[model samples]
Target: MLAVIRYSVPESQSQDFIKQAHVILDTLAGEPGFQRGRLARSVDEPNLWALVSEWEGAGFYRRALSAARMAMYPLMILMVNEPSAFEDVYVSGQEE
Candidate 1:
């Protein structure tokens, strides 16, 4: 499962947001079933950021979200849109 969270941060707060995002990623890394995660920023629109995470399954992702430590991050309040989750269907050059 994949989780994609998009954010629109003001220029003044971009640095602070990045710092907090790293903290969230670090926290998730210690959780069970967390495959990997990364943070990306749009080249065309610097204030636009995305937090992408891959989990072993939907249940693992849900557990991570419900973790008590996750509740402390202010990043959730700054999201520009609702976070999205997707199940992988296919990958190019990969066999089933």
Candidate 2:
């Protein structure tokens, strides 16, 4: 599995950004290699968000996302984590 993490400050035109973001997410969701995506925001830091996407190991998420959202994406830090262990929502767990 691969997880892509994007960090960005909220734009002055947030609604417009969000609208454009949905388009990208929707397109990716329908792609054959996409597994799932989770959009998370920090309660204490309103301007921060993490878009975590899981993809098939064979897919290149960066290229696909860049192609789909070049116009909509503002300058931001993007990190891709592959060959790293990630949480599986379907797994049974024992907590600390």
Candidate 3:
């Protein structure tokens, strides 16, 4: 499943957020079902960031995300959305 997570960090906490962000990414990467992950920043909204990840399956994705949610609650506002439909396509220009 493809999971898309969007979150906002307060301006004052940006540095701290960046510092702690790796922990979450690393934890997810170590999970058995985790496939890939990416971090994104908005072109217009400076404080907004996004996390995009894929898992081996739906159940595995849910479990890993739930655990990460609990661990990251104290940091900032978090919003997650996983669309029920997705397709994995590899463009010639894209690298895995």
My TM-score estimates for the predictions, one after another, are 0.88, 0.59, 0.72
Q: Where is model 1 more than 4 Å wrong at Cα?
A: 68-72
TM-score of 3: 0.72
Candidate 3 or 1, higher TM-score = 1
- Residue 92 deviation, candidate 3, in Å? 9.6
Residue 22, candidate 3: alpha-carbon lDDT: 72
lDDT score for residue 20 of model 2: 56
Compared with the true structure, the alpha-carbon lDDT of candidate 1 equals: 0.83
Candidate 3 residues lying further than 4 Å off, grouped into runs, are 76-96
RMSD to the hidden true structure, all candidates:
1.7, 5.4, 3.7
User: Of the candidates shown, which would achieve the greatest TM-score relative to the real structure?
Assistant: 1
lDDT of 3 by residue, 1-96 (tens): 677667776688877776667777777887778988877778899888876788887787777867787556655454444353244565367678
Query: In angstroms, how far off is 84's CA in candidate 1?
Result: 1.5
Computed on alpha carbons, the lDDT of every model, listed in order, comes to: 0.83, 0.58, 0.71
Candidate 1 clashes between residue pairs 3 or more apart in a chain or in different chains: none
Which residue window of length 10 is worst by lDDT in model 1?
68-77
- Model 1 TM-score is 0.88
